[model samples]
Target: MESLRAPPTAAGGLFPPLPCALEALPLLGVDFSSAPSRQKPVVLAWGRRAGAVVKLEAIERFNALPTLAERLSAPGPWLGGFDLPFGLPRSLLQAWGWPLDWAEAMSRYARTSRPELQAAFAAFCAARPVGQKFAHRVCDGPAGASPSMKWVNPPVAWMMHAGVPLLRTAGVTLVGHAAGDPARLALEAYPGLLARAVLGRRSYKSDEKAKQTPERLIARKDLVDALEQGRQPWGLRLRLSHAQREDLVEDARGDTLDAVLCLLQAAWGAGQPRGGWPGDADALEGWILGAGTVPAP
Candidate 1:
């Protein structure tokens, strides 16, 4: 037997090597869908980072969650920044009297049907005062992400219901939560958080073809240009072929660009200690990968 125990940590006692050092490994930025389809599939941007330059190598589209799940299950020393919530709001979980442990909470959540979840969340909101309907995870304030429990608009609650279970099944180690394959690390990402920093309320994408105006197109171009030059916050420049740049900008839906933004965020996290997640990330309410300072609850 080749010693059934796991491999030893890095020289600094890090369980897994920091991402910045693993420049040769693939970094994935996933723009996930709670309900993937032929029209709006799950989009993944794959690349490798060399110092501050992240080279875009490929763009993958999966028409179904199973396909995405299959990709995640494959062997990896790969790190992913998935645009999905890894956990629910701690306040919501406690109020509903749900399990607080990550595993148990997710297990119970997996079993709950979508309608039941919607009804539960609706009831929770109905009881709260106006302007304070939904409970928020600590990171939501800083990340500018929607409440994970929101059932409409972005339907992130459904995204959590549809996506998080697949990640759990894939056995990737969700940062600050369940530990799995040390080589495969997953972090919650909000591309809009990064985009807003660069674009400043400018709209870069729209799902409705009719709403995809020329201004949005220009915003996309400007955003891409900023990334290539290495904008603030992360300071990592994006290296894309002219064709890749055109492809990202031309895809009016913005899925490709969102995925790439996530990849950059993941790369930034990889360079940090413990994937940039804080030590006190909630037990059942995970934090976004690069969202700075948790606000006071």
Candidate 2:
């Protein structure tokens, strides 16, 4: 077995610089979501090793757009397993008449304001029957997302609208999209899919400080053990130490857990073709802009 202390190196040199060495370690899982305040939204990149899923790194919060730009700009061959919605529901798109392609739809969506988009979506939904109004994107079904365009669902649509462009601009290759550069790859990942599979309905993390209790710690430990042993149906595993486990458990919001989940998604993507996603054909779509479905008002 390889020693955990050994640094991860790539074909050219050590990966991700020494400071971000852990991130370079292969089989990194990530969980990303926007932590938005009244001022600006922060993109939180959470990571964990594939084998030792329990151990998590600190939340790498990027507050400014420039910082995110710099990180995305950094030399890569590094795959990012982002938690944002990669596709919109098919139903929503047809109703709204947005561009069907991923890149084109995003460009059109970006031009509109939040309120305008919300109003437009609302009007569309209001006319439809209550239960069937909100449409899910292809990714949302397996990933189980709240309607892709829902504002309360942490503005994931906005995240896709705002963030995907940056990845494209950064020259990263979206795994299922047209490859602008062979070196950098972006893949759609959902940590919840993995988490639910292993520990259904059991809460693994909490943002509220009060939820970080002894019981949750034990649950996290169990979750970590399962991943390390590749006990899940997904064949995922984690590698970590006692101290690392304690550290990850201490932060209950599951930041570390989420990061590891993202890492796993990235690893899954690495095995697929440049223009394809890792899962079944029905679950994935080619890199089309505005890929998610729009909800009716």
Candidate 3:
């Protein structure tokens, strides 16, 4: 996970500067997709607190977004940190003459196809000077994330498009977007935020099997060690069995690790009041859970 400092671990499991609080809600971290498949399924890391430590219960994967949505909509309570942009950059939406309100913007966007979205974004960039093509949202700078509208490289723009609407379909309240259900709350999360905090620009995983190496494997092990020892500046300890540790290390795609990062973030949020959300959050521009300040230019 990517992250920044300026916060410390507190009793009750709050991660300061982010308003995170601790609790034992059914915690989850999701790595999502618009077109989910077995090859690259939607991954979820599920866990709950066991006395002083968090015990990861399971790692679940689904190849279809609709199926996952059905499961998320099931009754009772759960909270999750999803790795996708909850809102678009306000400036980018305005330039495209799209709706500025979060609901409207998302509704309009969900109707569009990936190909069309990419073409439009490319055309806009083509007309602009180099390096000034993309407009950013409030969280991008502080979160150190790519512009939400970029369609290539990481293709986060498409991710936002495919992912956020699922919360609505599942009737899971998006904390910043709608009146959230305490029973089923969904918040934005980026595993990179926390991973960066721990590793500091150290490369960890690769999709191409050929790129997976012993060095990267060692890096992953080191990361797990830091997490297990309660070394987070934020101060939450990850308690895993020897088998669990091996499972996390064995998965080279980093999907399980990313979900675990999101899991920790959710664990922190569960500990906070109102999920450690700041009062200044806007309905139009969703804020990241751990970010202290708004994203900059």
* Top candidate, metric lDDT: 1
What local lDDT score does residue 73 receive in model 1, on the 0 to 100 scale?
Answer: 95
Per residue, candidate 2 scores C-alpha lDDT tens digits across 1-297 of: 221112322211111111123335433343444443423334344344443343344445565656676777777545567766655665677788876666666667777887898898788778889797776655565455566677664577777766667777787666554455555556666666666667777777766678767777777777777766877655656555677666556657776666666666554444333222322332223221111211211
Across residues 1-297, which tens digit of lDDT does each residue of candidate 3 receive?
211112322211112122122343588889876677887788999888544477788989998888898889887377789988888877778789988778888998899888898888888888889888888777767777777888877888888887887788777777657643446778888777777778878878887899988887988998999889877656778988888899889888787888898888777766655464555455576766676532222
lDDT of 2: 0.55
Per-candidate Cα lDDT values, in order, are 0.84, 0.55, 0.74
Roughly what TM-score does model 1 have, to 2 decimal places? 0.92
TM-score of each: 0.92, 0.74, 0.87
Which candidate has the top score in TM-score? 1
Residue 166 lDDT in model 1?
95
Cand. 2 TM to true fold: 0.74
What's the CA error at residue 284 for candidate 1, in Å?
A: 1.9
Alpha-carbon RMSD to native, per candidate: 5.0, 8.8, 6.2
- Model 2 clash count equals 41
The C-alpha stretches of model 2 lying farther than 4 A from their native spots are 1-30, 35-59, 210-215, 273-297
TM-score (C-alpha) between model 3 and the true structure: 0.87
